[model samples]
Target: MDSRVVNKGQLPELLDKLARDHTLIAPVREEENVTLFKKVSGASEVQLDYITSDVSPKGCIFPQTEKTISYTYTGDTLEMKEQDEPPKTVLFGVRPCDINSILALDPVFEGKFLDTYYLEKRKNTVIIGLSCSTILSTCFCTAFNSGPCDGKGADLMFTELGDKYYVEVNTEKGSSLVEAYSQYFSKGDTDKLAKAKEEQAKKLEGQFRRKVDLEGVKQVLDENFELPYWDKVFKKCLGCGICTYVCPTCHCFDIFDYVTGEFTGDRFRCWDSCMFPDFTLMAGGHNPRPSRKERVRNRFMHKLKYHLDRYNLDGCVGCGRCISKCPVNIDITQIIKDLKEVGQNA
Candidate 1:
């Protein structure tokens, strides 16, 4: 990856230039106390200091309600309309955790049946990730072999230093963008850039107050299915499902059709949380994991164990949205720390 430095106070103009060539989407605080990744006409709207947002950036690509196709019933024949164009855009200011979740989700969406909707949007977009300097008590990216500096899913990465930003071009698309937008940047200076990067790296690599013991986390969680800690830990859970809805890595969802009067609209899928008792309810009036303890157990187990078995990677990126968002104040890092089998910090 080629690295360079952009001059101070020019990010907005650079974003405008990028928006001219591509659809730029960055974090914008729309309403009071809400941040969303939306189309950026200019960089002035981007909120770089925001650590966590109410809505996950995943919704930008995987919309809450997407019309797969339109169909109208005509007694004899039916007409169906399929999408003609693919989505072309750029997702910028992505955090390392959110970016890794996108990559982790690649196998799920593109693994067996190619989710044309997701793939089309993915293929057309470029991810520009930024190093995380702010971390909440719940952040545990280190557990998943990721950090603020991990560039796993980003085509381009940005690290803040003083008032300027250090850019790393990770892919050919990113390299070309840097080359194309050379006017906004200055020649790279190795010494200052190195010192700046080291400063950023130090915060990402060492500032975290909390992290998980991940080596045997999967194995320990797998073998401790019968652990009695679940009941005690989730005793206060109201099961409102807000945690998963805000989580960037929690991807469980359900698809169903909505009918109005004589006809049905397109099939739709919305974010679903495992914390809900009805989330796993089976047919014939039976639910295997019916208790709150089970629901709580499943959330952690899926993040630390099931995802590793299914995707060869841990499901959690530890963005801390779940921690700050949970109404009951249940913290996952505290749960992991209390786990009997997961080795304690040295």
Candidate 2:
């Protein structure tokens, strides 16, 4: 409940204060055309105005590769070293879609058996979701019931209002944050906050020019699985996996051990995509999802249908990164749109 207007000029000092108690991680401009979230010392480096980051914040939650443990060999015994660098993190300027992805994955990782590594970090990290003043054509968080200034996953949500920033502290962590850094903020009137939130919502929602009926996607896509649509849509599907790697919600991963002449490595997991041909291949080379059509079809089916059945939530938040970054320009939302048409005809 602790909330107030933080003077724009004092943002860096506020970040400096937070960094004292935790490892501050925020979005930083890597180069002219690229931006990525990294460990930051000050808030001045946060590029909050960037349209969209080149990579998603999934790496912050579900890392690309992590060593579960390391082992040392003695003459007759092996000792293990557990990696528990699950330090508290401040994920600043996280986009709505990226934050929702983490929230959505909560049930998956915490459902059957709690993944200690992910859980520890998830519990410790405090999200500061920034409003997307401008939505990229690739952005579609609205389709998933989340908006630009959404306070869904953020401990503290910040929305810019001309010369000042409007703050909404939604959780205990956020309340603590507001209390900890009271000097930077002011008690602002309702008129500014009310108008600021409304204006940002209206503008960002319009920026998502492309729209879809989120409710209709699951049934349409699942029922039309065997249709000849996959071959036609993924006609030029080259099977490269750049789409999933860049996706904010694509969480499939693979575990492997690297053995070399110098050292014996521990088991590590890396990001994996279903688009790869070898992904479905078995030991005897007997593959289930053999063709390119199957591979492409499986990708969509898993996103819309399988995940819905499993988690009762849409796996794809309509971030549309796959469509923008796909080598073949395969729009997942467009695919769902076409499937809805097919259902109407049938």
Candidate 2 off by > 4 Å: 73-77, 260-264
- RMSD of each candidate relative to the true structure: 2.6, 2.0
- At residue 227, candidate 1 shows an lDDT of 74
Residue 318, candidate 1: C-alpha displacement in angstroms: 1.4
Q: List ranges where model 1 is wrong by over 4 Å.
A: 190-192, 260-264, 340-346
Worst 10 residues of 1 by lDDT: 337-346
Q: Candidate 2's residue-wise lDDT over 1-346, tens digit each?
A: 5557877777778888777778888888886677787888776677778766778888888888887776666657766777776888888888778888887788877888888778888888989888778877767778788888787878988887877778878898888777777787778774668676887798778878787775666777766768877779778888899888888878888888665323445768888989998898899989998888898888888888887798887788867778888887888878878887778777
> Which residue pairs collide in model 2, if any?
none
User: Each model's TM-score, in the order given?
Assistant: 0.91, 0.93
Which candidate ranks first by TM-score, i.e. highest? 2
